[model samples]
Each structure stands twice: as C-alpha cells, then as structure tokens.
Target: MALGGGTFTTMNKILPGTYINFVSAPRASAALSDRGIAAMPAEFDWGPEGAVFAVESGEFEKRSLELFGYPYTHEKLKGLRDLFRNIRKGYFYRLNTGGEPAKNDFATALHPGTRGNSLRIVIEAAEASTEETPVYDVSTWMDDTRIDLQTVKTAAQLHDNAFVRFQAEATLAATAGANLTGGTDGTAGDAAYQTFLDQIEPYTFHALGCLSDKPAVKALFTAFTKRMRDESGVKFQTVLHRYGQADYEGVISVENGLTGAADDTSAVWWTTGAQAGCAVNKSLTNRVYDGEFEIDTQYTQAQLEEGIQSGGFLLHRVGDETRVLTDINTFVSATEERSSDFGSNQTIRVLDQIGNDIAALFNTKYNGQVPNDAAGRVSLWNDIVRHHQQLQTLRAIQTFEPENVTVEAGDTKKAVVVTDRVTPVNAMEQLYMVCVVA
Candidate 1:
C-alpha cells in the first residue's frame, strides 16, 4: 500500500482536505469616501505628456516643479496657476494629462514644451574623502537651483531621472552648465485633449474641465460624458465653458464668468474645481467664487434671466460680491411632469450616489457567493435596505418606505430582481414668504 492516500478519478471518488475562500464584508463601501478629484489637460514643462499626472492637494506647487520643472507662478504656467488656485481649496487631487517635451542638444526635458529650454545641466566632481576614485556629481538644474543630482564616474554610469535623461556617448568632465535650447511646446489640438480623455478613462473624478472653446472639442467631451455615464456605468459630471446644450444631466456648461488677463477661459479652472469639490449631500447654489479670477458679471437682468432659462451656469454680482445664482446643470426634461427635477445638480448627486453605492455593493460582496435562493435574495434586500437607510440618515433622500423596496427571484433561478424607489432631497433654493401687518 502507498504511504499516503492518492486522489482517484474512479466512479464515485471523493478526495478533499479543505477548500475555503475568504470574503470581505461590504462595509468598506459604506464609508463616505474622498471627494473632489478634478481632471484636465494643460501645457506643462516636465513629466510624461499624454499621460495622467496626479497632483494631490498641497503638493501642486512642489510637485509641479518636480514633475513639470516649472513653478506655479511661472509666466508660462498661468493656466496651471488658475487651476491650482481653485483646486487648493476644494479638490483633493487633480490629474494633468497633456503637454509634450522639448529635446535639446545634451538632454531632453522630462515633458514636452518650451519650458524645457529653461533647463540646464551642470557636471562637477565630488571630492573624495579617502584615496579612491572621485565620483562626479551630475546635477540637473532648471534655472539656478539643482533639482536632481547623480554621482557617476563616467557618462555611461549616468541614469535617466525625472528631470532629464543623460545623453549617450557623453564624457564626464566638469562644466559650468549646459543650458538646454530649442525646446518647444507641442501644438494643443482636440487630438491632444482626446489623448487626455483616453488616459483618464480608468480614473474616477467628480468633474472634468474642458478648457478649449472649440465646438468639435466640446462635442467630443459631451459625447464622452454621456457614454460614460449612461453605458459604461461611470457617474461623473463635466464642466465646459459656454456650451449651449441642456439635454444632458451630466454636463454643467458655464455661461458667463470673469476672463482673466491671461485667458478668457480662466473661469473653467475654478468652476471645474468648485463643482467637483461640492459635497455629495450638499448643493452649490449661492456658493461664493473664492477663486483668484475676477468674474465678468457685466450682464443685464434680461440676459441673466435668459441665461438661466437657456440652462446656463451663471454667476452674478450680489452685494459687491459675485455669487453663483444657481448650481444647475443642463438637464431640463422634455415633459412637464418631470419639471425641473433633473435641472438641480443636487438631485443628480443623490441619484448618482445611490447607483454607485448599490452597484459597488453587488459587485464587491454578493456577486456570485450567495446562493440564488430565497434566503440569498433576502440577504441582498436587507443590504439594500441598510444602504438606503444610511442615505436617508445622511439627508440625501427622503420619504423612504421600507415596503416600497422589494427583492424577488427572477424567471431564472440564478437571477434576482430588485424594485425600489426613493425621493431625492434637494437643498432649499427658493422660498415664498407672505408679509402681513396687524
């Protein structure tokens, strides 16, 4: 007889020690997660162009130089500065996804742009303490300050860094500095913006900003936003400047705002960050534009009314300050019964949260583990009830009757059907007061 029992492929054979797979509870999805991730494309000095670059809050200034090789206040970084200003207050992170690098004689800039021309490389010899060969200090300098330093005896030993790549067949010799020249920015076209979209498709952000005023570019963004929200199951809104379409609930078109000296579309920067930073349970109506751009509110009352009627995201002057009149997106329904329900961004937030949370719960925990029987269906229903109850507690929705939520087995034993409804709560945007004197 064999020392150990072996598995048999015979007729009624069974051999098993243990078969177990661990599963995590769906509690992680219940937490109120981070908010305000805004994505956009811009001209940058360094970093990978046509790829997503994540800049977390408070890291923009330092990371900009480290990655883009330029400061926020650089003359060529005006647009980036505008974006960082609004993002500083609201968004937790911003994703930059455009800009090509400029190549020079000695080394190429980390990113594509004329800013690369400002970079200079300095090679010096680091003194040796002992009786050994001296290590050369190869430093990458943007202007005066050294950003990266590598110690190498020969040019062949130099490795590529975030700032620049070492030139091949280069001799290691002490030189004052070799300034990079002929670096140029890539022409920004809709194709460049499309590259950004493609790179950011897998990312999750609250709002996407479209800086370009081109009709074709705006159309592409609108189509992308709609497809992502409706078909791809990704829920997020987009902010565009002066877009006239009000048929989609996922797009917020900025009608009028202050045009800074640098660019007229500077408002796109702040608006995108602010809309993205708005909490899921709150509305942005009447919120103050605390950004750096001076809004252009030189509009008549008639224009204001027309702008609102035409589904424009308008800002207006109020008591020596500019405030958002309505935090509405372009989502006016065609039917009278629908009314202006979808027009309010707050409503959309609630609905989006519900859809996202429920889908996450199903996909993460109950996808294929639970049986498709009565008990399993009840478990799913219980989870759904708990989730909606939590949303109700958050004041995101109201009028939730437990009886309205029902989960039943579908025609197929492997499927289950869920039917539930809840009234989404919106912030009080209007009031009717009657004054009476005794």
Candidate 2:
C-alpha cells in the first residue's frame, strides 16, 4: 500500500475472497481495486522483484504466504488433493500438447468495443495417475458492471455524435486512465512522486486480453522497451495499458519457462489459432454474445462439463443494409470535436466505416435532438422504438458524413437542419440509435 514514500506492503492474513487483504505501497490498498488484484499476504507474498528474491534464500523469511485465485479452478480438486504429488506428471503431458508455434497459430486483434477486461495466470496442475487422468477445471466471477456502459440517452456536450465509432480505442483509454497514480518507470523505491506515478498500471485495461496462447500472445503484449545490441537485438517495450477485469487483472504477460516465440513449430501455430480459451469474460474473437471466462474444473470428472457457462453479453449483430442511402442530410450542428452537423442536402465524408453492421439503434433520450423534417422524424422515431427493445444493439452505419454545418447566424442554440430536403426525412432522430443487439 503506497502513499508518498517508496514502501509497499500486503494485507498479512486472510481467507479466499477476503476484501481487506491486499498489497501495494504504504496506504496503497485502494490501488488494488484499479489494478484488479488482491494482494492479501494470505494469497500473495508482496515486495519488489528483487525484494522477494532474498526470501527464497535463508536471508529473509517472506512477510507472508499469498496465492492468487484465478476466478477458475481445476475439477476433482478435493479428490485430486490426495494425489497432489501427481501435478508434475500431468503438466508434462500438457507441455507436449502445447499445439503449434506461437508466431503461426497465434492471433491478436484490437477490438473497438469498450466493454471488456484482461487476464493471465500460471496453470500448475493437480497430481494424477495415467489411469485416472487428472483434469483441469475452471470457474468464473464476472463483475455485474462490465456491461454498465449503456447507450447514453443524453449528455449536454459530446466529443462526437457517432458513439459506436472508436469504441475500442476509448475503452482502452479509460482502462489506462483508471490504473494510474502518475508516472511509468521505477525501481524498488524512487521519490514519493515517482512511486505514485508507477503504481497506476492495473486499472487501465487499455490493452484488451493477451487474447492468445502462451507461445504467442505474451510475446506480443508484455511490457518492454526496445533496445539495440551489437549482436542485433530488438527494442525493449514496457507494459503500456492497464487491466482490471474479473479477479484476473494485473500485468498480463507470459508465464515463466514458457517460450514466447519458441523454436518449435506447433507452439507458434497454437498461439494464433484458439488460445487456451483463457480469456476472462468472453472469447477474444467475439464468438459469444455475453460470455464468462468461467472454468468448472471442480466438476471435471462429471464428463458432461464440456460446455462453458457464462453470463449474458451485449452482442452486436449486423442488420439489413439495403436501406442505406449514400446521400444524407446532416441534422444537428455540433460545436464539440470530431462530430459534424450538415445542413440540408450537403454531403458528409463517411469516416466511420468500422463496425459489425450498418444500421443504428438510437436512444429516445435523444428525441429532442432530431430535426423537424418528415424523413428525419421517421428515422428518429423508428430508431428509438427499436433501441428500447434491446439496449445494446448492432449498428449498420457508424461514421457519419463529415460536413461543415452552417446555421443562420442566430441559430446557435437552435436545432438546425442538416438534410438538403426542406421536408423532414424522419423526425425521431433523438429516439433512435444505430448499434443495438439483434
């Protein structure tokens, strides 16, 4: 728990899921929430990298014993405990099954959606005999608030009217902002100011999940700055974004002893294909609507646990695209950055082309913002009704035509018309949204 000094400590004792146990700098317990880690001495041994190094030797006893619970666990845990010595044997089998080379099979994609988290952990196995075949079970505990960033009905000012566009970028930014106290680089203890700047890493989930297997995903995402060597070395990079999703939030990186870009061929391929399904809430590929990175290893022996169970997601799907008109009249005049309001038949540059679809499901809270024309009213009204049915829906059109919206000099506060037509195209502009789940 860090305050202004360089000192850090963990809550010395606790059981699983105990809220009070955590580690940080002096008075740094609050930082745990943003980082999504519980550093209770019961589950973790806290200190700087080398600070804990001496404990392994006889030089200093560890301040405490701490273990991390990765929202999931292996099945037959109780039964497996009896054979705890067998974990090493089972792990070797898993090692041989590392699949393909990370560079080949691994995949990574930066999603534009902002509702998600990150995850990573070591997966030591339970002891088992070849006859019984020990299994690894997993469970999940997702935050109910993961889906709380609802369709905003009304906000006096907006950076952009097009909400769906750049969602992934914005989400990443928020995660970064939340995880910081101030700076980015540090050793054990810098000045009081330096320590504060260094601890803000976990809460900013700017970078999404490692999203791939040990052999590949970690190679792509760990924090390192690039460096040059006479022997031909690449630059080192530092971990940039923060993550705090589910119980598995912290610096997402590769596990030790695991080859990142291994010389092996299969390991590379496995990294790009299907990651060990290790993501926390949903598949990195957007396969399920609302998913949980839940593992039910406790029931591994049941044989019926193949199906993964998860909570709901605000899945986005493409809607009908035939109704799209290349021509659209800008309706609202915006003073905010990144958005535009075109007046009448003027054309707007379509910059928002990235999305799962082409139509919009709008919020009725914006009903007042629609233009007064007939067509504008219709589009606005229809979108509102559709959004009420499903809060987070898919949208076909994301980027609006960028145009210069000019209203008569005195119409500053008034809702100026952007369409070229004198009559309204649809009046319910504020009521509708473009991105809703189908």
Candidate 3:
C-alpha cells in the first residue's frame, strides 16, 4: 500500500495510509486596485450586435473606424469623443439596435449605419509579368481612397474582406466602382438601455454615464443601481442628467448637462468618466472641467447653493475657468441616520472601496482554501485585520483595531461568520469657522 494515499473526506482509512492538508498563510497586499473603468450607452455606426465592449483611450480613434466604420473625429462620434476626452479607458455599449447594413452591387458593409454609405468597391486587373492568369485586384474604398485590397484569380478565391464581403459567386468581372447605399442608423428607445443594463450586469466598472434626459429612463437606472448595490452587493455609481430626485447614495444627478451653447445635456458624458477616473483615496470636488464642451454654468449663486443642497452635481465659474463645486450624491434624507453619511461622493467611494476590496480578499484568498475550524476562523480574522491595517496605512480608513475583527463558526459546519467595524475617511469639502478679530 502506498503511503499518504487514502482520502479523508468522510472516513479515514488510517490502517492503509495517512493524509494531511496544508494551507499557505493569508497575505494581504497594500497596493490599491485601479478604478477608472466606466460604462455608457451610445449610438455607434457599427459594432457587435447587442453586447458591451472595451475601448482604451489610446486605441479609440483607430478602433472606432475599424469596428464602427467611422473615425473618432467624425461628427457622428462627437459624443463618444467627448466621453473619452477625460477618460483614459472604459467599457462602451451601443444602445441603438436593429438597423440595415448598406449594400452595394459588389458587397455589403459590415455594420448598419450611415457611414457605410460612403463605401465603394473597385475592381482592377492584377499587375503581373504575364496577364495570362486573368487575376483581378479587388479594392475596398471609402470615399476616394481604398482601405483594403486583395488579389484573386477565381470567384471562389474571393473571400470576405474587413470592410465589405463579396456577394457574387459568378465569373470575376472588372468594375470601376460600386457605392454602398441604404445604410441607416437605428433608433434608440428605453428598452435599448434596459438591454444594455442587463448585458452589463456582470461587468465591474466604477461609474455609469446616462446621456438621456428622460425621466423614465433615469428612474430605471436608479432602480437598477440600487438593486445591484444593495441586493447583489455590486458597488458602482451612476451619473444622469437633471435627475435630482434620485436621492440615492449610488446615483449622481447632474443639474446642468450641456454648455450654454446647446440645450443638450451632454455633460453626463464627461462627468461619468471623470467621476470614474477619480482615485479611491481622492475626491472630484473642485475638480476643473477640462473637456472640449463648455458645461452649462449659468446658475446664480443661490441656484448653485440650492443645487448642492439637493445633491445635484453643479459646475460653476471659478474666475475664468469652470470647475466642479462639490462632488455629491443624491442622498438627502433627514430621518434615516445612515442616509446622511452617504451624501458625499467621496464618502461613498471610501465605503465602496472598502466593500469591494474586502470581498475580493475573502473570495480570492480565504474562500474554500481554509478549513472551517476555529484555527481557520482565527486565520481569516487575522487576514481581515491585516487588510484593514493596510487600508489605515493608505489613509483610506482610520481607527482600525485588530481586536475589533472577529470570526467564528457559522450556523452550519461548512460556513463561517465575520463581524468587524471600520471608520472610513472622507475628504474635506467645506470650511465654516470663526476668525478672531484682529
């Protein structure tokens, strides 16, 4: 009989062999995780059907044309460009659905949008020492220039290209150009956003930007955010335009969206990214608006104060520049004791960071790896203490004590219980003091 070969689940066959288990000591890292990812919906010229995708700031321009059939600087991409002006990277979902792809006599555009209408297919004779093979040079052109080219001798050699796919299976015939037509942009509805929310539920992002001013759409987002945070324990914030009554810790309602030039509330595009880009230990209060669009800052002093009182995200002129006055969430409640602390977005960030970090620590390090014994529980408590200690070291929390953390056996042998307390730190936002008379 081999030594240490028997299993130890239900009964131990000690007579035949012996079994033992070893676990590594829990280690908590002090490095804070990066947290600038954001999510939003938009009308794109092209993309995958009904899904969310990521686009980094460095690749947005190139990827936009490659995937969506339009360059980042195109007029149709202004809103998306504005979003990326301050955001370095993020996940984007297209809300508009069900559109027809533009088709030409030679091929069809990859996605449905007006941008595809500019595409044209050109066929020319292949350049070779001998033209006896009768090979053709196929070129995919957008406007006057060709984007993709291929050489094929037979119709069967003609494969699908990135810009357009081949349609004809007959004999190869040279043509001057065939312009694509009938490309149209799909319409956006409330259901489209709902689908986007559902598709993005599993994704982790710091903030969500809602560009619509529809009350019903805003309400749907508010409800979805509350449910995800409260029920599922997913932590993230959402920014919407002119949704002051949202009154939730996870929701930010922008009082003004567009700059004074237009009535559109496009400010949500930038605010969402900026809010997400803020570090966990920092705050966006008094942060300046450095994007292209001039945000609407036409509010009077009284109006600005009222907007803050109502938990609205307000931008005001600080001398010649416009800056965020106070970063706040819509959580105005006089009765509920815990509701008051949730007003500041910084406070929410701290709490959310703590929650997300601890959950990650537990799930990754402690879950199923450690046994359900008293020693294992104590080890978990120790890990928790170390995690909190690191948080304190980073100044994200204060007054953390190892003795405050406790872990014990749960109602069942397979479960464990944990209890702890922490005092999260918040940024300074206001100054009200009396100066002695000189």
Q: Highest lDDT among the candidates is held by which one? A: 3
In model 3, residue pairs whose N, Cα or C atoms come closer than 3 Å (at least 3 residues apart or on different chains), thus clashing, are none
Shift of residue 314 alpha carbon in model 1, Å: 1.2
- List, residue by residue over 94-118, the lDDT tens digit for candidate 2: 1011111111011111111111122
The Cα local distance difference test for each model comes to 0.74, 0.20, 0.80
Judged by lDDT against the true structure, how good is candidate 1? Answer: 0.74
Q: Which ten residues in a row have the lowest lDDT in candidate 2?
A: 89-98
Q: Give lDDT tens digits, candidate 1, residues 130-205.
A: 2377678888888877788887777788888777877777766678888877765545555777777887888877
User: Would you estimate the TM-scores of all the predictions?
Assistant: 0.84, 0.16, 0.88
Tens-digit lDDT track for model 3 on 281-367?
778888888876767788899998889898899888899898989989898874656857789888788878777877887787678
TM-score, model 3 to reference: 0.88
Superposed Cα RMSD, model 1: 4.8
- Badly placed stretches (over 4 Å) of model 2 are 1-207, 210-369, 372-375, 381-438
